[model samples]
Target chain A: MDKDKFFSNDPRFKVAKKEAWIGVGLVLFNFVWWFAFAYGLGSKSPDEYTYILGFPSWFFYSCIGSLIVMSILVIVVVKYFFKDVPFEEEVQDIQNQSDKKSS
Target chain B: MQEYFLGSRSMGGFILAMTMMATYGSASSFIGGPGIAYSTGLGWVLLSMAQLPAGYFVLMVLGKKFAIVSRRYEAITLNDFLKSRYESQWVGILAAISIIIFLFSSIAAQWVGGARLLESLFNITYPIALTIFAFSVMIYVIIGGFRAVALTDTILGSIMFFGTLILLVAVIIAGGGVTNIMEKLIAIDPGLVMPFGADGNLSASYVSSYWILVGVGVVGLPQIAVRAMSHKNSKSMHHAIIISTVFVGIIMLGMHLIGVFARAINPSIAVADSVMPTITMEVLPPFLAGIVLAAPMAAIMSTVNALLIMVSSAVVKDIYLSYFNPQAPDQKVRSISYLVTAILGVIVYLMALSPPDFLIWLNLFSFGGLEAAFIWPVVLGLYWKRGNKYGAISSMIVGVTSYILFHQFYPNAFGMHTVVLPILLSLVTFVIISIVTEKKELLQAVHK
Candidate 1:
């Protein structure tokens, strides 16, 4: 359990950590935001059954409208912010180096 | 085919998108989900949209990190990643068992869906239909493997995409436009036109929880997660996100809308699940109806094959090869893998012979059970470096046990779905156990 060696101010781990938080943060934000807009805005009124595009107002915005918004948002997020982190090769390199040192 | 079954790990954007949609869209989406919507009304359509972002969540959350990490480990299955990451046989074995156990319900749901579809379409007896579907899927899966599954899914996905459009148009025409359909529905019950269902049965709290269950919690499903390990690059993931999102949006809204509309046309349907095939046959010409019918067949076959492969891979690769015979030859592993998959299919077919009430419930139960069991271990194990095997095993145990208990004794506990409580409980258990074990392991490492 040489935990320190793996975690000790390792530049790769640092970058990986930052990337993870940003990714998780963005996903969580979208999950909450989407549900709010889908249900909160769409189903605000209980008694009335409003219609949009011949659909119940809540359904029109919550599903069809929200789906269009979601598609665009997902593409934008992936394009601009997401990075390709090479976790495999980096982890393997460290393991190889350790094996050599131990021998 | 070998690469296809075992993943070539070099799929392009279009193939990746098609495969993801095909695998995710199942008998439930095509037959069972639409059936439920027909009876439940427009409220169910709104709830089904929670699945619109499913592909996005799985691809993005797991993303390049999971693919790269898996390549580094040369891991194939979700349980393979678990075994390597946690460095424990117990964790690996538990994961394999969980996948096999939970996936049965999913596979059986597909079988029943396929049989029901066939029974209606061919006008055959239920037993004959069941046997036909069972044998066809079993033989095709055994022969085609994962490559067969992916190729078929690509074809099936395209059918569903076009089938949805054609059916929606045909159905709208049959019902004398959406306006007339609305009039008929309003005539039956003004409540049918409401957002909260015909009787206001759909609650705000319940709707919100479905967003968690089908939307966010999809990241935990092994069959879906395994797709993360197969793409060529980040570009494929991005493409998958856009294509699948759009396709799912249309398929869900279109199919379910067709369901709600079916009531206005034929309100006296004896069985709700038959509504889809019935409407298709009635609206489209006989020649075209056959093509449209293939979409559900495709959906059922694709879903069952994916589940079968995942279950078999979990058994052969994770447990048998890893434990009993680490040095078993490749040919032997392949043979046993095929055998295990066939046996699983037959078992599910038997279960579907006397189909129980609420077939989709079995599928949803599988979804929640898998989400609870694997969500914490997979997500935290990747993100939180402090996570270890003890935490992984304990998290799985608590997650699975609580989900089952809650499902049986206290479903929709506190108005939210059973999954919400178990996922939160497992998250707490994983972190606490990890922190407590970290120091002791550190001390032991120092002693060593």
Candidate 2:
């Protein structure tokens, strides 16, 4: 296969490259937001208490935040990020061979 | 002749074993082990039990498909597999960068954990300890690659397993058995021995969220995910599953329980992290202590080595080879791989010197970051038909951004981990975009 054929010619490659740019955006945003939170809010004071079922409020918040983020991630992955694209004829042929072997 | 560069014969069984051992080992078994025991009393042992199934779960869940897909694509790294399967450079690069960033922090934390372990064991300075630990790991990683790592990991895993058993027995014997220790812990502050943590600090939400971080979300982790890709075949996969689960479970339970039990043996201990080292030294003879202490070192080194290899591969294979020097020869790639791996290790060593107060949190922080970054990209990229470039990009952007924002400002915003929000936001972004920009041709190809 030619160089371009390996990457540029492949539709999947085109889409993946585009997605990577998006990932870059995400990382950039994360960096900015995290720095702001850390600097703006300062470190959490251990002496203070945020209660949830008799636990500190910070701990409770962390748990809730984790759940919300993960739920959203799952939905996005299942619904959008995981879309199927048509396989090239050559690639399909390879898949067929592999399937035959597995069976 | 295409001499299989990815899986070379140079990587024999011993090296492969070591690599596996090293990859699976982490600071959790060292600093967190004793820390948990020191605070929770004996109940930490029960908590450790949860880890036993970890290895088994990964192997079983991802089993056949993982190995087959990786092999078919000639994927040496987790990012490579994702790139091929999704046919997306963005997925590959995102996976690579995320691995680099998160593993950098994770590796640094391991270095710190190793240095701390050394400092506590010997009267050495933290920097010196850090240097020695970092150099040792970097050398083996650069020279041996995956094979060496696997071999070392097997040895380390064995040490961890037996070491936990030996220490557990010794602590029990010294503390006057389980019943006596429980009584002492109850007297000290009944909460210490409870399922929650010392001071009744561990909340239901926090503990459950741990399932995502250490449990299910583990699927997204490159260090672990790569394992799913490396096995020889289905039978090997099955064997690894059984072996890994039992081993992880025993070690996790044993180490954590030992952590909690140490409190009964040494209630006056101030720094929680020091509990394990102190208890081991106190319980066992000096010679035995020396031997047992190797277990933690083994754990730290193994984890460090794995992270080093992984991050290095992310840089060399996914980013460098795929993007910068796509036409570079094999020899050039090999040289770059070795050089980059060493450089990365050194940088992490520097980062590790200062060390964190709660080392477990540092490790978990990296874990959370990686999961948020890669979970949707890898999983949805595999199963979804509508997953488009727009959707994948949006999901990643949302997942990572929200994760960072929550982690910073409203960490545990809703009593959940920071990762939860970002993952959800990214998912919504992924679906909406894919549906809106649904391309008939792309959808048909991906669906078939």
**Candidate 1: which pairs clash?**
none
lDDT of 2 at B372: 82
Put down candidate 1 lDDT per residue, A1-103, tens digits, no spaces. Answer: 4334333554445544554565456456555655665566555443455666676665666667777777777677667766544444565665576689799
Mind giving the per-residue lDDT tens digits that candidate 1 earns over B102-157? Answer: 99999998898899999999999989999999999888888887877777788889
Predicted candidate 1, C-alpha RMSD: 4.7
Worst 10 residues of 1 chain B by lDDT: B1-10
Instruction: Give the winner by lDDT.
Output: 1
Model 1 regions lying over 4 Å from their true place: A1-48, A84-103, B1-5, B443-448
CA lDDT for candidate 2 = 0.64
Instruction: Give the Å shift of residue B225 in candidate 2.
Output: 0.9
**Model 2 per-residue lDDT tens digits across residues B1-448:** 0122234323332333334445655776677656866866433443443343344444434444454445556667777776765567887777787888888888887887888888889978888878888788777777777666666677787888788789988988998976677667767876664445666555545544555566656767888877666555333443454455445555665677678778878888777677788889999999989888898888888788778878878888788888998999888988888889878876876777677777877887888888787777666665465566667766766777777788888987577667677767777888788777777656788999
Candidate 2 segments whose C-alpha is farther than 4 A from its true place: A1-103, B1-22, B42-53, B439-448
Evaluate model 1: give its lDDT: 0.80
